[model samples]
Target: MTSFRVKSEGRFVAAGCALIALFALIGAPVIAQEANMLQAPAGMKPSGSVPESLKSDSSSATLAPADETGPRRIVPPGYGATTPSSGMPQAEEPAGPSQFFPAGKRASEPSVRMLSAVPGQDNSGIQIGTLTGVDASTAGLISEQQGGLGADMWQGASRADIDRYLSRLPVPVRSPVMNDLARRLLLTGAQPPEGASGGVSLLAIRLNRLIAAGQTQAALDLGAAAGNERSPAVAAGIARAALAQGDDRLACDALKDIPPGNDPAHDAMAAFSVKLSAYCQIAAGNTEIASLTLDLAREEGMDDALFYSLASEAAAGITLRAPEPNKLTIVDTAFYRLADRELPENAVEIVEPALLQSMLADPSVSDEMKVAAAERAAAYGLLDGRDLAAYYRKPSFTPEQMAGLLTSDIPESSSLRRAMIFQSIGMAAAADERIHLFKLAFATAESAGLYYPTVEALYPELDRMVPSDALRPLAPAAVRAFIAIGERSRAQDWLSLISSGGQMLGRDARELTGLMRVSGGSPQSFDSEKASAEIVSDLKSGVRATQLYAASEAMMLEALGFQLTPAVWDALLDARGALTGDVPPEALLNRLQASGQKNAIGETVLLSLDAIGQKGPGAVHPRASAQAVASLKAVNLESEARRLALEALMARSNAGRG
Candidate 1:
């Protein structure tokens, strides 16, 4: 629970920081805080401090009134049932990016510059002239559009509402400001202000805002403080919010008002509440109470699809000791999953091997859970390569799913065991799953330090795995893996298939495959500009971090050669910048100059590298450092090349530790 609070607070604080940064970029003036601004709901304080009030029985506190007839609907501004209409005028939403982040502002202008060298001048020969001024006021808005906490926080929240709230602040704090603003706005609209006993609409709105901001503790505390308005509707709302945030204890506390009872409503809401209550009980470790609660729900007329579907999660963990009455039934698939969770131990009465095989074949059981069961069997020395083979031979799971599951939760050391399991099973997998599984086996093998056996089993399937002509474009990754593992023949086979089918590899993929071919007399090749563009595409497409790191590593390997492509050159420069504190400038300069020999990369690259190395601004607009070193070496000026290399290394070392 302490750790949970720490983690939750961290998440909220991070969100708050993002909001603050967004507000700063938008030119929103920060408001000074009154003493009350620092106040938050009990238990919502930063980690390491707990309010004594929260330490008490939180559910016993007053709650906002609930309407048993139906959920509360917040009346829009200007439509009040009790007080005279305030008639708040609605502001039309911003219609375009310009409305929010205005253009033509001083910061929104752009500038251009031109560079030329006076013929045969020394290092000082080149001059850069500004051709245009630059404005960047719209830059912040464009970045926000790209996605961050600012975007997520602003989502579904009206800009008008936020602006009104901000205008009231003397100086806004970060994320907590959003929560406070939400509370203030809700209260401002409440017909009977703060102290008055009214409907739960204000409380509901505030709690919703808190929940959206991931400030669940504040929401729970606020729900408990709503005095006379506390009702089943309000309590249920708070409980639902708690459950959504994974606070089972808070949810259980909120739902206590709606205890299990006979003659529950036959409608969907009642059914859903009943199901939620049961799960809440289970989560709170009151298994017997949960079981009874679930039974009572079934006893009522709650057979709707929505109720059943929500009930499935709890049903998946329930253990039935004895057969129950038919009326107490639930979806069978859910019950089977519950049984599967306990696996070999629960299935002790069943025979070996078959039990393990059945566990894999069961669709309701997740691959992750199955992996756990297999690991458990392994711990007891009962797991066999044969049983593993059976899991793959039957083909209920895909290689990608299994790989993801195996890696998702386990310790790094367990990856060794995973490698062993894959090696055992790869040979027996059906053709459809074989290549993918072998690839997984190969990838994990390196980490396990058991590369040979994994590759030995994988080599045979290489040709068979290459997709047909139209699909060749998609198998570059498969080919790259073969090259990485030194299976040159298989790599060639796949490349030939791709070529025969008349498909072109993506630039990065082509360059990578070319690196493999370079060992077989094909020239080492790369396009630095194309590589950088490809990297941006990968980032935009949300490629996983692991994949990005692999790509970066490949670029670094290519940078080792004398001819630096734009991509490789930039990657090396970035790497050098990243490694600044780790390696001294002098050592790097010595290494680059000592290794110098050049082909394609030119003088502009050397000049940039020289400037960067010397802690000076680079003169070039487009390319960078390693290109300069290679370019210098290409012109047969070994002495100049070495000096520039040394300078670049020194500058790199002075940069921040990556």
Candidate 2:
């Protein structure tokens, strides 16, 4: 018992090394030993150095609670803690980006995977390849806006958020804080230490402040220096802010600073910057700009999030906010298209927006194609969904009537030309309502480009024709959405939407067409055109195109699990060709497969082989089994046996005959 008492006292003496000598000099009250200290010391040898009696945790020796309550070992002014307490809460949440970081926080590792979702669970989307992105600008702005800015600087933060949560200095429109942080950033050299999170935090704070203060130059410098170190959210915000300011240059500069090595974030930043640049340039009236900003955004080749955003934007103008605006975002979906150039009668002043986006991205698309595509997109953009395919009800116009107003700048809409005009003409009719005719005629006459109808001019024409009732203009899905939302009315909205979409509605052929086989100007097989055709063919067979499109569209998606395959499309086409002497299945499949995609002709070959097997080895194609078996085997498909077996049964039916 006496030995146990002596050991407990020794631990208390050793517990407060820094405090021990000082307490004695102040003549402070002697500290009492607690039950916790009464246990065996950490790392004490089991080799019997200490008495076996002291090893037991049942020691009765204990110090009474201090009678003279002096300052505790580590207490606040009101804190009464002397010894560690027990039975505390088990689970605890740790402070992170929004909390305090340690000194040299820039070097401190941030938890890319946070535990905000649930206990013992994680949903960190952060990838090893995408780490080191900048978030300081965003973090600083968050602190500034939420009134938590002072908390960071005052109490210091962890190494995770941005290094040091300091206040950002204000800068101007052209200057970013790049110069200010340059020395410090350089002093740390190429690599930061483990706890340099403070530096990262300070850099972010400075960046956000400069951006808010309109110091674009400094922001640009900071962005460049940070390189691919910013987070996706941060890069996106900076790009957006730059664009909102109408400074395309700064936006582009900021985007370039995003490390090229970043995964989706860099691509996301690129998509935003490229789209904005194209729109801003066009807005400034660069009607004839012959380069490609929109194209780069499309094929940024990363950032799926950005891709969806851009596509959504492209569909926005025509299909603004209808429940399903995209349903009408097509030339065939337009009303009042012109027959000559294959435009909707309502289309006016939209030629440049459509045609120019592609020309700006890739200069090689034929002038004729650019003009046609632009017209289609513009027509779709201008259309009102309530009356999709309602052009037949619209009264027809005389050739002279059209030529009297036909302008030189009218751009052609590619495949959409025929469908859009056909739909428009279908909707034309001799409705006695004066407003109806006026709306159609007025829409027909206004031609700044592909998609525009002047209400002022059209109203008078309608009054001249029917001269009764009011005209109503409800665009096809998305187009109507824009009208209802007045999206085009606002300069900012127009710019934002335009920058957001320009290529969202583009035909895959447009993208693929650019990768031309120069020898004969054939579309590169891997382009959007082949994918669209194959996908469409699959859908036209009764399935909606969207479902089967997943195979060709999503790179990671598996081929359709259904028995049907793209070969079916080619085989049908081939049979149609062979029967009509138009295109043989074998010839067509072989050609189409080259640029269209694998398995494009797989089903066709399968059917052909099955037919051959039924013909008892005299199949027209003669090599169906080999073709089907080979392709199926490559995908680990066991359906090969089925194709061969089905052929055996067909042979008995004698399909070899007509």
Candidate 3:
């Protein structure tokens, strides 16, 4: 929301041209204007003959000294000197064509005095390009003179009105191809007619591209002009653009123009910025940059979120291992302060997880800073599947302190704070196995007086933040192996390491033993002896008895000399849930007889079942059942095997007890 506000306010519209024209003409010495003049970057002077036709309609207006409280200068994308965003879009490309995930998020709005085309209330039908119904003559005139010039000219003609004039021209009429008349006139001495102050606004709309193109010196020179002569609004705008375009040094120069204010907007903005930048510099693999930036942002007022954004990103990058790629530094904070100076709102959310990511790694970020960072991240409300490298590195929240967040008079700020709390709750839930932990975390977040309505606050950022180090990094194969090998301790450990919110479905040894016994004792036809042996083999192999009937039914029938009842696996499954936790004693007895085994093995199955029932979840699970003992008689179709089975059970069970 803040970023969006910044982008929209950064470039003001001319609002019928009168407002800008009036501001520019209010106090100027009405020099007889000649042909329209072209703008040029500093050191590149323009000199050319004026067209005779242009001279015929020369115009001039009186202009005023700019008010100290005039509106702020707007910044275009890629304008900051400190923010180093690559061409990386915010999302991955595999899901479809190239597109950013968590789409349609707006840029941040600055709180500083807004430099706008006009009050938003002034007009309704205007297009960003032109005042909707202007006469063709005026359009043609502005169009013919306003089109075609790049980085250098833009820096000089950086005011919003110039951008507005640029917009009014139809694309075809505003061709960049300069004719001899136009080019020659620019070569001749032609100062762009003065703007609102009868003075050129140094910070231009085209500042970003110039910076991108490695024209840093030009930006600095323009900034110097603004610093020397413009109001805080224009100066700050230039500073923000330079900062965005990646030159903190120039940004520092711009910062000097920010007035001395007790409200601390400037101070906070500056302090919060470097505090984090220093930390992130180390985390994002640039200690020097982080340190230097940190030192500079420190000069910002404590209220500034830029400092915090840099700190959090630095800290989070180190802690969580994932850093946000599209980190817009302090562009929005500067504006937001001017928007509502007395009641300055926090500006941490504009360039999020980057702030979130960068801070996690910075060792210098103190505990108090973390609390500040977590609160801001939670408020931003991370989305599902969004990179959460920062949130994962350290606790996303602290339960202790939440001041005027909820109580703030501005409902919007309060609501945003609540949203942050809700997100923190979710993070807590993921970390602590209990839902209660999540609730507590969330409640603590809301206590800050922030508002949160839905889980929507913590968006599509799937459980990606649950880190490997934070949680046991168990692979699917590892989990499978643990399950197969009955490594319950290890399995549970892994499960706990991951988020607390998942289910497991592994069979218990005790449950299996009871199942075998219940099947063994059930009434079945034919000889019980062969049935007993088949049941034991199935149990050892972890196959259910019903399945045994499908393949082993033939062997059992022949051995029994008679057919038994239906396969027992199905009956076991049916009755299993009702039995001990899952296997009822009665159901087990029934399944026992259904196995078509003898009285001997039946005893072994029952004994094993009974033992497990007496002992509980912690008791040693019987490898063989009570009936297997009774089946001991059956097992020694050879006595040696019978003895071995009994010995193995006793040894294992006793060993378990010891």
* Top-scoring candidate (TM-score): 1
- Give the least accurate 10-residue stretch of model 3, judged by summed lDDT: 171-180
Relative to the true structure, how large is the alpha-carbon lDDT of every model?
0.34, 0.26, 0.28
The estimated TM-scores of all candidates read 0.25, 0.19, 0.20
- lDDT digits (tens) for residues 408-445 of candidate 1: 44454453345344544544555435544454564554
Tens-place lDDT digits, model 3, residues 146-183: 22121122222213333332222111101011011122
Worst 10 residues of 1 by lDDT: 96-105
* Highest lDDT against the true fold, candidate: 1
Q: Give per-residue CA lDDT, model 2, range 1-658, as digits (tens).
A: 0000001111111111110112222233432232111111233222213222112243322110023353221001121212111222223222212101001101122222211111011231111111233333322211222211121221221233223212322121110111112112211211211233432233444445444432333343444445444553345445544443333333333332333221224654344433433333232222112022233333344433322322233322211121112221112111101001122222222322212222212343333343343333333222221222232223344455333322312333222332233333334564433323333332332222222222211222222332122221211111222221222222122222222245422222221211111111212233444444544453344432222222222111112122223444343333332211111245423322221123322222222222232112213331232233333333333332223322221221211011
Residue 310, candidate 1: Cα error in Å is: 15
Candidate 1 regions with alpha-carbon error over 4 angstroms:
1-147, 151-248, 256-268, 276-299, 304-658
Off by over 4 Å in 3: 1-235, 240-246, 252-363, 366-368, 377-389, 392-433, 449-658
